[model samples]
Target: MKKKVAKFSVLPVVGASIFFYSFSTNKAQDINTALLEEFKTVNEELTFEVPYSPDAAVFDPQLRSYPALGKSYVAFKEALGFKESGGDYKVINEFGYMGKYQFGRGTLKLIGIRDTNLFLNSPDLQEAAFYANASRNKWILRKDIERFEDQVVNGIKITESGILAAAHLAGPGNVKKFLRSNGTNSFSDGFGTSIKHYFKKFEGFDTSFVVPDRKAKANSPSVI
Candidate 1:
């Protein structure tokens, strides 16, 4: 009898090929993943812009993306003035705070306004004062705004505009204390308005465009 010749079958070869393909694909993926992880960890201190959390975005959706202190910002502040003193530039609160934005004497001076009457009587002056004060406050709390914006503190989500508004309502010093204390150090104006109230009322507007300037003046052309 002739010796049986071995049958050549493709099945064993095909099985080995498939196994090698799968193993190669998995190994490639593992290598890519490791490279990506390394790239991300390359610089631990690298920072990036992040979206505001839902609760932190307190402005009306339409107002959320408005440029800082832009047209809509002007309108919002006008409405705020309306709420505060009926948009009456001449109205002085019982506490002696005057004008559309209800500024105090010290705050006016800080913004380079020496005449309370001019600050309250001139619409241009009032507008400039509002913008100047907002800028000054934004400067004072710049770091806090960066760190706390989009974060929840004392169950209230923080926003840049909200922080500025709070600083306006309470002094920047008070706002700092309140934020650092995580809402424990509550403050109310002589009018009895709380910092939290300002935070809530002024939430979700963009104040990031406001530059921090120690020399921010109400008479500055940019503010006016």
Candidate 2:
């Protein structure tokens, strides 16, 4: 009778142990499922929360640098700025050319920017000055652009943006002489940067945003 009692007691203990083990296993599975669901929710939120724009400039992840800006107007301006003052808005060269696009005091006066210090300090004013100057140059070289575009002068193909850039480098009158004389009338700056070099380097950019205005001014309603 004692052996029978012992066997029944052992069976009950074993059944309780099995029940506890099953419950613990189920509880662990539920915890893991909850954690996995939380991780997936966080991942989805992260994926959807980031904003994107098609026109925004993209940076190179591996190199941690800005790649080429393509043939856009942004590319043209930034590239010219890089070439001029290494894209520094506060830089003044030895020849007194100021700002990112390196405008001379005389040139700034032509664009209605009388205050040289204000023009140098204000980035918005500098940008407006650049646009204004480009527009004036475009107007000055309109005939030359129409005549020399796509034509190979001195083995370099002429483009509208290139012509404007050359005008920026050596003035519109010099650019006109260069084009009319088939590149023989080339002019260089104080740093020996030639008009032909500017023409070749800044070619093939979409500068159509610049309207040819003979009277373009920096403070004008149209420019700013």
For this target, which candidate reaches the highest lDDT against the unseen true structure?
A: 2
Model 1 / residue 150 / CA error / Å: 0.5
Task: Point out the worst 10-residue segment of candidate 2 by lDDT.
Answer: 215-224
Which pairs of residues clash in candidate 2, taking residues 3 or more apart in a chain or in different chains? none
Q: For model 1, how does the per-residue alpha-carbon lDDT over 1-224 read when each residue is reduced to its tens digit?
A: 13332234556677899999999999999999999898888755585779776666356666545445543566557656876788889988888888888888888888888877566668988888888888888888889998898888898888888888888788899989988999899899876889998887788876655778877898743332
How much lDDT does each candidate structure score? 0.80, 0.88
Query: Which runs of model 1 end up more than 4 angstroms from their true locations?
Result: 1-71, 220-224
Model 2 quality (TM-score): 0.70
TM-score to native of every candidate shown: 0.64, 0.70
lDDT of each residue in 1-224, candidate 2, tens digit only? 99999989999899999999999999999999999999999998888555775796668677665677789888898889889999899999999999999999889878887787777788888888888889999998888888889999999999999998888888899999999998887899999888999999999999999999998899733232
